[model samples]
Target: MRVGRELTIGTLSRRSGVNIETIRYYERIGLLPAPPRSQGGHRLYSGEHLERLVFIRRGRELGFTLDEIRDLLGLMVGKHTCGEVQTMALAHLDDIRAKIADLRRMERMLAATIARCQGGGRSECPILDALAGG
Candidate 1:
């Protein structure tokens, strides 16, 4: 959080805990604005860049897709977007719930299949049978 003055790309990467390649890729994908260059052509990043990168990293960690992140960023210009943001968040939460349900189902199936396994040097495997759609 020592994000005061202009920083090099390396400094930004270290400060934000995001890789340099990811920073460049974010710039390429329009998630991040291109930073200005120094006299010698080295990219000079402002504190705002560091903040934005942190936001992006957190969004990614929270399972927000890049396009959804872009939407969030676009909505940051005004307070009127709170309702919209909430709607998007709810949709994402629903998707997460559905995925959790699927994962629980998978866990149950796997556990049941494993329980059926005797595993006494048997040539037949319940695991293989389940995998083979049996």
Candidate 2:
């Protein structure tokens, strides 16, 4: 559908790949504006809702927290400069890089533990010994 056209909540959920409850939660958190309700009290979402929901879902998949997504959405609405959005994205990138570094450290620790236990019996298992605080 075209932007600005009305759609049912189900349609929006399907199109956006976001759950119906999540859509409601976004509305409650002010990340998304509450759409107009139909005569039957059902939510009638418009194209703008679809666009915003897509943005939210994509941001979530990229590891952004709801608060970060909110800031990005605010920037979009306010027509802020691209530099501001880039700054937020760069911060998120740094966070992801740090997590990768932590995971690499964990991998090294696990590998060392495995190496220490290779061909060892249960009584000599350094992995379990380490876990047991030995």
TM of each candidate vs. truth: 0.91, 0.87
Clashes of each: 0, 0
lDDT of 1 at 134: 85
Please list the residue runs of candidate 2 whose C-alpha ends up more than 4 Å from where it truly belongs after superposition: 118-124
Task: Give the CA lDDT, 0 to 100, for residue 71 in model 1.
Answer: 88
Give one digit per residue, the lDDT tens place, for model 2 in 15-108.
9999999999999988889988988898989898998999999999999999999899889879799999999999999999999999999999
The Cα local distance difference test for each model comes to 0.93, 0.90
Colliding residue pairs in candidate 1: none
Candidate 1 TM-score over all chains jointly = 0.91
Top model by TM-score, which number? 1
Cα deviation of 76, candidate 1, in Å: 0.4
The positional error of residue 42 in candidate 1, measured at the CA in angstroms, is: 1.8
Winner by lDDT = 1
